[model samples]
Target: MNKKQISILGCGWLGFPLAKHLISKGYKIKGSSTTVSKKLMLAEAGIQPYIFKLGEDNNQEIYDNFLSESEVIVINFPPRRIPDIINIYQEQIRSILPHIKNYQKVIFVSSTSVYQNTNDWVTETIDNKPEKDSGKAVLAVENLLKSHSKENLTVLRLAGLIGYDRVPGRFLANKKEVANGQAPINVIHQDDCIGLIDAILKHNSWGEIINGCADNHPLREEFYTLAAKKANLTPPEFKKSETIQFKKISNTKSKALLNYNYKYPDPLILVR
Candidate 1:
């Protein structure tokens, strides 16, 4: 059997690591970056890097060529700087939708932020009532992908991404009063993120929304206090009367459907 070609959009941070993992597993990877400097890195990692930018009136031929003849497409890019994030993502999805071939599996890297700030356990079946601008934008793009994409689409709603030099210790190293110190932190390590994606690709799972998060839901102060102690920093003071709110997103669907186990299930494990 011929090896499947997998194309990854936005090969930076999580995407780059994912591409490297796929390549190490003997899959052909084509990745994209907006910057010219990262092209060399992508090439060195054995990924065919395409520098594609999304906008109205942008060249479609380039995108078409990049997406051509691919068995799987992973949309991992985000409009980080755009003010009208929803419109930007919508246009980008529309531009790429026509290029995707039928029957190809697509994984849209979404976020758990789409769920409202209610202090309840959230799952794939939760209503998407986003409270923030970025969350709303992501929800819009997810809807667009589900409705318009020709391929079988699956949405992976990830929690706060951690790992690969992004340690929690540095976030509050010298901070005084940090907001929401008592809220439970919803985060997942990069290794588990890649593992979950690998499981999905290996199983050819599609047409579902999977919550990609760690099994552990530690209170913010407890985890951060440990992280600070490990880094030799003082733990930030938490407001005693303030109620920190967050949604504990469940990964039951990912575990049951994909038969995948998390590599780093606990948030405190990384600090040790």
Candidate 2:
């Protein structure tokens, strides 16, 4: 049997590493980037490189080749922080809807921002009520993809990503009067993110929505302070608040369904 070919739409921070990992597991990877320079880099990393821009004019044959040859398509790009992102983001995904066949599985990399800060534990079943514009854009795209092809789609809703270069220390280092001091944080390391996605593909888990987060929920004040300290940066000062708003993302579905174990179960330990 030949190795399965998987095409990743975005070869940025997460996608780049993911492609390399998949390649190590004996799978062929076709990775895309909008940048011309990164094309050579991806090729060097053993990924079939393609220059794919969703809303812009792309080489139709190249784009089709990127989408057509893969057994699975991983849509891993994030919504841009633009004024008209809500409409533009949906349009970007919409452009590729026709090319995606029913047999080919899709892993839409979503975010946990789709859930509101209910100050309670959130699971897959809860109705999405995103509070931020970015979250709203993600939710809209999720709906679009599900409606377009629900059977082959799986939405992996990841929490705030923190690992490798994305040190939480720099996020609030030396910051004054940071809000939500007592609010619980929901974060997953890069290793866990890759692991979760691998499990999905290994098990052939499709048509599901899974939340990928660390098992431990640490307080914002505690986690960030330690993270800054660990990075040799000035610890941020948190403002005292009577009310704490937070959403603790649950990984029950992923753990149970994927039979997976988190590499970084505790964010506090991650910084320490």
Candidate 3:
């Protein structure tokens, strides 16, 4: 069988590792970097690196080359948390939709933030009511991808990613008066993300919306405090209010459809 050719946009935190892993699995990986300097770095990792920034001049040809000769394309481009980008981030992502159909499959890397914090368990079928700007932008991208492809698209709404080099403990270390102490956290490990995507590709699963998250749901205060201590950092203090608000993201759809066994099921244990 011919090796699977995969083009990954935004070879940053998650895409970089996924590229390396795919290479090890005998897949030909094409990666995109916004900066020219990173091309050497991507090449060193055994990825075919291309430099292209969506919504920029001369990007059409660059995107054409990047999408060419690739059977699967993973649109992992994430907007940086800048106000301007987050505001029009959907348009930035939509700019590439015109060039995506050449590939046999597409993975639109999205975020679980698309689901409003209804303080209820989140599933793939839940009604999306994004409250934050980031969530709204992600939803718009998801809709754009869906509109473009009926049979070849897979929308992965990833939960807060936590893994190597990403010690979540420090996010609010020593912070005081944090609300939602009892709220549950919805996070997935980078390892699981890679594994789930790999499985989906292997199984040829498309036209699905999957929520990539861990199986366990730990309290915000408990998980963060434990994470902080594990990293030898100061624990954050949460407000001891009686009001409890939380949402536990469910991964039943992805697991059942793909038969994926999570490597880091319980984030509380994976903090180390």
* Winner by lDDT: 2
Local accuracy of candidate 3 as per-residue lDDT tens digits, 156-229: 88999898899898888989999888888999999999998898898899999999999988888889998999
Task: Tell me how candidate 1 scores on lDDT.
Answer: 0.86
Of models 1 and 2, which has the larger TM-score? 2
**lDDT (10s digit) by residue, model 1, range 1-272:** 66789999989889999999999999999999989899999999999989868654675887788888888999998757578877777777778887777777899998998999778888888778998888988999898888865349989989998997887877776676677877888999999989988998888888888999999999887888888888888876766677678889899999999999898989888886
User: How many backbone clashes are present in model 3?
Assistant: 0
Colliding residue pairs in candidate 3: none
Ranking by TM-score: 2, 3, 1
Q: Which 10-residue window in model 1 sums to the lowest lDDT?
A: 52-61
For candidate 2, what is the lDDT? 0.92
Model 1 stretches with alpha carbons more than 4 Å out: 56-58
After superposition, candidate 2 runs with Cα above 4 Å error: none
TM-score, one value per model: 0.94, 0.98, 0.96
Clashing residue pairs for model 2:
none
> Could you say which candidate leads in TM-score?
2
